[model samples]
Target: MTPDEARTLLEQSLRVVVPDADLTGLGGETDIRERFELDSLDFVEIVERLSQGAGFRIEEDEDLRTIDAIVGLLSRGTPHPV
Candidate 1:
């Protein structure tokens, strides 16, 4: 999928994990972890959801060490490493 498509999926995934969050104003550069106050478990869940939504094994491809990294990975259509 394209970066835009991946971004949409990421947004949906974020919403799934944090429905009350105001994601409408977020952009590709938004720091999800800090901005949403996500913990390690929440980060894991978000990655899993993003993987499922994108039809890829994200956790096995790249390290999602930061929200910027996550966005970069998604934008490049790359998966997060396990």
Candidate 2:
């Protein structure tokens, strides 16, 4: 998937997790956990949703702190160890 597509999917997943989250003016590099006040479970749910939506398995150790990082991972199709 393209970055734009991945970003859209991420946004959708975020909405599913935090319906009232204010995503406006959210930067690519912004910390999602900080911005949305997501706890560990919420974060995990979002990651699972993203993985299911993107048709890929995101490992637990992946650097998914920022939207940019998640989008990059999704756009790459499949993840490999760095």
Candidate 3:
């Protein structure tokens, strides 16, 4: 999928975790976890949703660290686990 498509998916994933979050106002560099005050479990939820939604496995801490990274990853396709 394209970056835009991945971004859309990320927004969907974020909303799944935080229904009332202002995802549209977030920039590319936005840290979803910090911005949303998400705990580790919440982040895992986002990762799970993103992976499932995009049909890929994101099995790394770094992979889901920021909105941009998540979008970049989903856009470029899945990366093999390190």
lDDT of 3 by residue, 20-62 (tens): 9986677888888789999988888888887788887778565
- Residue runs of model 3 more than 4 Å from their true location after superposition: 79-82
Which regions of candidate 1 fall more than 4 Å away from where they truly are?
A: 60-68, 78-82
Clashes of each: 5, 0, 0
Candidate 1 clashing pairs? Answer: 59-81, 59-82, 61-81, 62-80, 62-81
Candidate 3 lowest-lDDT run of ten: 73-82
- lDDT per residue as tens, model 1, 2-81: 66677677778888888998877675467678889989888889888877776666753466655456666766664444
Model 2 Cα lDDT, one tens digit per residue, 1-82: 8889999999999999999988889898999999999999999999899888888788868999998999999998775322
Give per-model TM-scores.
0.74, 0.92, 0.87
Q: Considering every candidate listed, which one attains the maximal TM-score?
A: 2
RMSD per model, one decimal: 3.3, 2.8, 2.3
Q: Once model 1 is optimally superposed onto the true structure by TM-score, how far is the C-alpha of residue 30 displaced, in angstroms?
A: 1.6
Worst 10 residues of 1 by lDDT: 73-82
Task: Report lDDT (Cα) of residue 37, candidate 3.
Answer: 94
Error of 2 at 6 (Å): 0.3
* Clashes by residue pair, model 2: none
